[model samples]
Structures are given as structure tokens and as C-alpha cells.
Target chain A: MATVRIVITLKPGVLDAQGQAVHQGLRALGYETVSGVRVGKCIEITVPDQTARDDIDAMCERFLANPLIEEWRIERDQDRDGTGRSRVPVLPRSQGS
Target chain B: MMRFGIVIFPASNCDRDCVHVLRTVLGHDVEEVWHEAGSLDGVDAVVLPGGFAYGDYLRAGAVAARAPVMTAVRAFARAGGPVLGVCNGFQILLEAGLLPGAMLRNDVLRFRCTTVHVRVESTQTPFTRSLRDGQVLRMPIAHGEGNYFAPGAMLAAIEEAGQVVFRYCDAQGRVLPDANPNGSIRNVAGVCNPAGNVVGLMPHPERASEELLGSDDGRLLFESAVMWLETRKRSLVTPLRGSR
Candidate 1:
């Protein structure tokens, strides 16, 4: 089985109210060093075989995310082996930091 | 007689309310159209009432916007049929690309259900023809994702075209930050398409259509649509006053 991962997040300029609440909660818990937090959704889908990149892109663009306010990318575990894992770029640090 | 079609998607809570106001109270011919349907026959106007369609799975109105019925709605609007979307309906309109911009969670991250004062910014659209510019209407807004946002360029363009139909303002029509229930950019509460045939607002006009329920400012919207239809029928030529 091929496992596909889709990560969806709001665009940089769009406001993220839930993420901001999380940031505030972390600060209240004494995590002063953590300056920012932007929560996002990670969806996993298991397909019978390797899913085509075009299909995945369509899924993201059509149903997985709102193109107007969100950005999404897909990750595929093709080999099902640990070594073949794809790396994702980390979110940038908060402006205050 | 003017006929209005109300779309009823799964999990839609305000379909009945819209029907009650449009048919029972306002005495207009109304029909409930299912979301999966492909046609809107014999309808002069269309309404997408507020509700949590598809349980707001991906996003408010995101799933419903792709439903088959919206295809007909889009076509209807493209042909100059007046379309009004309220609350969740507004979100669906944005998702369907029938209108510009998007909706974000409320700035306070809470579900706000309250009567907000909205000032009509334009009387050009079929939906707002009954009200004068700068008229303040008391309407109830009940939603978590009512904060409206658009890119700077899009915002400026809509504002310049006078497509901004309504804005949250004080009793005296003062638009202040504190008066904004949601952090909608520039205190915008509603907007219309450039053609002035389609309008979407994050407030429930149906809920405020009767005085017993509170304010009847919303009734003017329905009356305006009916009047527009009647006027069109009499003239046989659309009396569209201005150009975008």
C-alpha cells in the first residue's frame, strides 16, 4: 500500500486564529521561548498503488485545501522504506523571534 | 408574481427560515432546490441560505460550492439573475469563486451570535435597491468564520467600484475597529459582484426579516429583489442603471 500525506496550512498573510490561540496557550504554559505557532492539518490516505503526482495535486487543489487562503503539498511514501522518506521544509520563525 | 429559489444543502439549518420569510411572510412564490440538482427552472431569483453544509468538513461552504446545484446557480447569476447568499451562504459564494476573497475564523476565535448594525454602502445592486446609501440595518450575524479577507489589490478594486454593499458600523454609521464584530478588512460586512446581480453577506437577513424576531431591516433585501423582477418584467428591457 502506498501512503500519501497532505499538509494544509493558511497562506502567510492570512490570519490563523486557531494557531494564534495555540501560541497564546503555549506562552501561558511558560514556554516563553516559543515565539510563534501556526497549526496545520496533516491528512493521510492509503492507496492500493502508487498515486500519480497529478492526481495528488488535483486532490489538494480541489478538495484538500482552499486555494484562496491555503497552501498545500503532498508527500508520498513510495518505497515504504524508512530511508526513502521525503524531507519537508520547516516553517519560518515568527517575526518577533 | 416573483419566484425565488432557495438552495437546500445537507446540514443546512436556515433553509426553512428563508422559506418562511419569503413565502409565508413576504407572500412570494418560493421553492427549495436540492444541492445535487442541475437546474433552476422558472426561478427569477436564487438564494443560498446560511447553514453548515457538509458539516463544514474542509471549510465552511467549501464542499457545497462544488455541488452540482452550484453549477446552475453560477449560470443563473451569469445571466443576470439576482443571487443572494447570507452567512454560510456567503462562505459558499466565496469558495465557488462567484465572489472575490475568503472567510477566516472570527478574530476572537469564538462563535459570535449577535445583532450587528450594518450600514448599506450601495443601493445599486438588486439586493440593496430598497435601501438608500448609508442606511443602517440591524441584522443578526451568527458564525465563526465571518471575518472577510481579500488581497490588497482586490480590496481596492472592489472598494473603488462601489461593490462593497454593506459595512459594519456604529449607530451613527461610524465604522470603527471596536464596532467591527469580526476583524473583516476595512469593516466590510458584505459585498456584491461587479455586475450587481450577485451579493453575499455574513449576516442572516432572513433572521431579521420580521419585527417580532427583532429587526426587519432584512425584509428590504427581499422586497428589492421582487421589485427588480417586477420592474424588469414591465420594461421588457433591464433597467440596469449603472455600469461597473
Candidate 2:
């Protein structure tokens, strides 16, 4: 099976009120170094290994995200072997770190 | 009397209010249509009322917009049937692509539930045909994500087409920054489709349609719609009779 991750974010000019509120909270917590913040969402779905890229793209365009105010990108991770060790970690650590 | 259909989603709270206003207050026939129903048969007009559908998961109106009944609603709208969506209903219309633009959280980051004045910018739509241009009406708006936003070119096109039906304004009908309650671009409180049959507004006109509820100014909108529908029916019949 292949896992598809879709990340959606508001367009550049659109206001991110929730993100701004979080930025303010970070500043209150002494994170003054933070310049700005923009919030977005990510959805992960598991589909059959034979699912075509075009089908996934269509799903994102039709229902996963709205094109008017938001933009979305898709990332696919295919599990080659029966073991899932090859799957990428949700949050991979920095290479140098 | 013209029959009105009010679509009731899983969490819709305003469907009954609309039915009461149309049936009891205005004395018109009303029907409550479930969201899953695929047919809007035998209704003169349709209304999508307000409330948190699908618990507003994913996004407000995002899930409900894909409900089964929307297909019928789209067909009805395409045929030039009148449709009015209020508050969350307005958000559904946007998400469903029945209307342009999307809503964002209020600039103040709070749910504003209060009364405000809006000026009728255009009287071409069925909902506002009886309202004079520039006439200010008092109504109550209750929502957190009522800020309207559209891309630059799309916004320009909407304005060029004169689709803006109502704009936030002060009591004297002056459009000013201070009068904008939700930070909507151009202070748009309500808008209609290019054909002027579908209208979506952030305000709760049903809540303000009675004097006991503080203002009866909203009643004019329903009255205007009835008058327009009646006139349209007459005109349709006149053409068939081969008379001017």
C-alpha cells in the first residue's frame, strides 16, 4: 500500500487569523525571535499500491482542498517491502543533527 | 401562496426558524428538506439555514457542502431557481462553488454576535427587489468566520458584475472602515450570483424578521422575494397567452 500526504495552506494574500493569534502567544512566551507564522493542515491517506498519481491529484483538487483560498501539495510514500521500516518518519530529524 | 423549501442539515439550527417565519409569520407554505434527499421537487424557492454542520469538522460547511442534496440544489440553481443561504449556509454555498470567494476567521478572532446596519447596494436580486438602493437595514450577525475574501481579479469581476447585494454600513448609509464588523473586503455583508437568483449573507435575517426580536426590517426581504416570484409567474403565463 502507498501512503499519500496532502498539505494545505492558505494563499499568500489571505489573512491567517489563527496563525497570527498563535504568533502572539509565542511572543508572550518569550519567543520574540519568531518573525511570523502561517498555519496549515495535513491529511494522510492509505490507498492501494496501484493507485495512479492522477487519481490522487484529482482527489486533492476535487475534495481535499479548495483552490480559491488555499493551495495543496501531495507526497506519496510507497511501502516496497512487507516491513514498514522503509516508510519515512512523520518528523525526520535533521541530517547533521 | 408560494411554497418554500428549507434544507436541514444534520446540525442545522435555523431551519425551523426559517420555516416558522415563512409559514407562521408570512403565511406561506413551507417544507423541511433533509440534507440527504436528492430532490427539491415542487418547491418555489430553497433556503439553506445556519448552524454548525458536521460539527464544522475539517472546515465550516466543508463536509456539508458535499451532502447529497447539494446536487439537486445545484441543478435547481442552474435553472434559475431562487436560493438563499444564511450564515453557515453562506459558507456552504462558497465551499460548494455555488458562490465565489471564501470566509476567514473574524479579524478580531472572536465570534461576533451583535446587531449591525447594512446598505442595500443592488436591488436586482429577488431577495432585494423591493428594497430601495442605498436603503440601510438593521440586522443581527452571529458567527466567527464571517470575514469575506476573494482574490484580486475575482473581486474586481464580482464588483464589475454588480453582484454585491448588501454592504456593511453605518446607520446613515455611509460605508466606512469602522462600520465593517468582520473585516470583509469592501465590507460585503451579502452577495448574489451573476444571475441574481442565489444569495448568501452572513447576517441572520430570520432572527431579525420580527419586531419582538428587536427589528422587523428583515421581513422586507422575504416579502420582496414573494413579490418577485409572483410577478415572475404572471409574466411567464402572460407570454404563453400571447399577450404583452
Q: Taking the candidates in order, what DockQ does each have?
A: 0.66, 0.72
lDDT of 1 by residue, A1-97 (tens): 8788888999897899989999999999999999788878988888767568888889888778888789997777853456655555457678973
lDDT of 2 by residue, B1-244 (tens): 9999999999999888899999999999998999999999999999999999878777789999999999999999888788999999999998898888888999888789999999999888888988899999999999999999888999999998888889999999999999999899999998888888899999888998999999999889889889889988887422211111
Q: Which regions of candidate 2 fall more than 4 Å away from where they truly are?
A: A78-97, B236-244
For residues A2-96, could you state the per-residue lDDT of candidate 2 as single tens digits?
Answer: 78777899888789998999999999999999999999999988999888888988887777787878888777664423563445456766788
lDDT of 1 by residue, B1-244 (tens): 7889999999999999999999999998998999998999999999999999999988899999999999999999988889999998999999998988889999988889998999999998898887889999999999999999988899999999888999999888898888899899999999988888899999899999999998998999999888888887887645454652
- Give the chain A TM-score for each candidate: 0.78, 0.76
Worst 10 residues of 1 chain B by lDDT: B235-244
- RMSD values, in order shown: 4.1, 4.0
In order of appearance, the predictions have TM-scores of 0.91, 0.92
Two-chain complex of model 1, DockQ on C-alpha atoms against the true structure? 0.66
TM-score of chain B of each: 0.97, 0.96
Alpha-carbon DockQ of candidate 2: 0.72
